[model samples]
Target: MDDPQRSLLYRWPTAAKFDRRVPKEKLYEHGTGTPAVREKFVAEVQRITWAFKLAETTINLAGNTAVPEIQIFEIDAKGTNVTEPVLTAIDKAIPFPIIFEINRDDGETRSTRMVAAHKQLGSGAPKIGAYYSTGWQSARTERQSLPTAITLPALYTALLDPLTPMAARPGEDVSEVAARLKAMRKLEREIAALERKLRTETQFNRKVELRRALKTKQAELTMLVER
Candidate 1:
């Protein structure tokens, strides 16, 4: 049985601070004095914060599951529990799948890592007297058996296969809708780029040429959107 409080499989190495120049004695340091480094660091951290916000919906959905566990390792570029403001906000937003660990850098002595390795080798060392499971036994094991999330590609494909809509349209499948949406988004991006270029263009002849190109792109975008 798994402990409810210890379920969230959070893992993060030490935080890497953003420094302008290479430190003489330190791997990374807070950019306190350097304005350029400070600005860059702030921007990068903001970008990461936005990414978490974007994935918030999915994270919330996962949190409601029977054995909920949220992984916060990947999002932390500057180690566990280092940043104050952004992390606090994210923590508040995530009500489910309570955080288990902040710094997972102590893998050298972790028994979970040992169990995972033992399982990979088709050995019964992780558990007592269990052996001879055929063909990639890890995927079939219950969710609570592993400390970390499953990384098998085929298992993921099999799990997500049923989520594919049965009949999206009369003659169209989900993949076609996805492809069409991708193409439409591409055209929209190209149109936006051309418009930005048209704004910066100075020469009269060049502006005229840009206008024609922009018009063509806009027409294509309209067609794609309508389809």
Candidate 2:
């Protein structure tokens, strides 16, 4: 289970700040090609701001060919929640990896959360993997200084460390962590489906078969979690 109290609000350096507003239409051009995605943007999103740019020039970090810079986009949401498809559209539009700070205003107070996918440069387009997110926290939450790292890629990994479901092993990179999390998600889904089937299963023989399958999937998930 994800720790709801583990929300991290990074104190972005002044040098790395690039507080620019991003137009929703710009995302529509390439990202929200589908009607459903476009509609989600219009309905759920209030505004998009390109809040920061972490790069070699701005932060004095060494440039990496795979990740030259990391972008932070602050999304002002119209409601308490924005769908994942809306986020997926924005990720599709941007070439670089992005960290999203989603803010929502209720009648009494405002809340914020950090969200991002493990993104990598692909041949045609960036390969965006499963998203990791921190639970909603108070907008007034104290911020922590950015994690120390040698390069942009390392910084990106450090930024996402708090959001991932599982901790990375000694030699594991962000990509490896993402892959493991993805597999875990798949196994979780399978287990849920099997459980649902078991609940409705009537025949004794069918129940036995489902039980066996469920046990196998559960064992697989346990191994992944322990690793």
Candidate 3:
């Protein structure tokens, strides 16, 4: 059986902080510094305050210049008595499905060393998951959409697919899929407003055409989401 506190148990690895330049000798020392202490404080804090454990650390390294960047993605602690690790106000709930990336320091040619990322606007915990699932259900309503939230050939005409896509996927710099989704929503709103306004002004044929288009869109979305 799934753990009841599973939601509290898993979080996106977030709250990243790291010094690009760490003196080898001072490494351990700096690791104990005030900042380091606070970061490490997570452990002690959890011991005294929360009833949770941050079991994973996701690190992503980037940059090629003199300084290299180490991005620390962490799942920290929260709450003291409950089965869940509830995050404090200042402390953030981790993003769902932890993600991050690292790249080699190759002078001019910095190819992909490592890239781990997620798709969707990570809202963290239950809210994020809900948004993700709901978004998919909404998108699935329009399966035939040439330009849908789903990715396809670049040649696919977004104007035809009629749904908004996303922006900045986790690993990639950014994806336009989000943008497409937004655009589709705006278009829908405009159409809806017009329909409401025209209900009294427009004729039956016009309404029929609009209804047909809407049904078609809904059907296509259903196809994409369902299968």
Candidate 4:
């Protein structure tokens, strides 16, 4: 006999991001239950655990017969925050746009974007609606709740501190301040170029740590200009 559920859960359309294929008979039976699509979704997610770094995964039946949410392990920051349920809590997303945060090892946070929704398909296997999504990328992240005060923490190593910011448009007293800034920028360029030239992982990580150390000094300089 054919493993119908697995069939529906794994098959993918030619170019679509997910599996929306469903059997005609089951569509009459449970297609009314929710997305005959989400079941296949979570399975696809399970297949890509390597990319997402997702640990555990669970799919729950929601009241909506067309949209199922997901719970996926996120190894990143927020220490395993419940994922799919968070998506469901949002506007019962259709074209499913999800926004979440990832904690980086360096005490900084990264923002993530995902989608969870329906994919209407032609005749094939059937499954529940899943928390649909593409993937995550590093992007701007603001501090929690306190949205206005800080912007994304700009990435600048202290090495860059000596560089002048806002290169003066005209000869506005190229003061001591300007020269220091120019020199800092030059040093930063040298460091970055050196990093790019290296091929060893050990050396690369070392350079990265060095860059981060400079971040503190860089922050102080920018802060000074702010005042």
Q: Cα RMSD (Å) per model?
A: 19.4, 2.6, 17.0, 20.9
Q: Against the unseen true structure, what C-alpha lDDT does each candidate score? A: 0.32, 0.86, 0.29, 0.30
C-alpha TM-score for every candidate:
0.28, 0.86, 0.27, 0.19
Q: Give one digit per residue, the lDDT tens place, for model 4 in 1-227.
A: 11112111111112222323223233223333344345433322222111211111221112121212222222233332225533342223222121222223323645343333222212333221333332333445321221221111110111111122433322222233344445555666655665554434466778677667556556655654452
Candidate 3 lDDT score relative to the true structure: 0.29
Which scores greater on lDDT, model 3 or model 4?
A: 4
lDDT of 3 by residue, 40-156 (tens): 444323322112122223223232211122222222223212111211211223222222211222344321111122223333332211111111111112223112222211212
| TM-score-superior candidate, 2 or 3 | 2
Which digits, one per residue and each the tens of the lDDT, describe model 2 over residues 1-227? 23576778888999989999989878977764688878888999999999999999999997566687899999999988777888888889998889999999977889888999888776777878877788888899999999988888888888887788777665566677788888999999999999999999999999999999999999998888664
Better of 1 and 3 by TM-score: 1
Per residue, candidate 1 scores C-alpha lDDT tens digits across 21-138 of 2221121132122454443335433123211111223322222121233322123233222233333333333332112112212234211110000011112211111111111111
lDDT value for candidate 2? 0.86
Give the residue spans of candidate 4 off by over 4 A.
1-82, 91-106, 119-128, 140-227
Colliding residue pairs in candidate 1: 15-78, 15-79
Best by TM-score: 2
Following a full C-alpha superposition, what root-mean-square deviation does model 3 have from the true structure?
A: 17.0
TM match of model 3 to true structure: 0.27
**For model 4, what is the error of residue 127's alpha carbon versus the real structure, in angstroms, after optimal superposition?**
12
Q: Total clashes, candidate 1?
A: 2
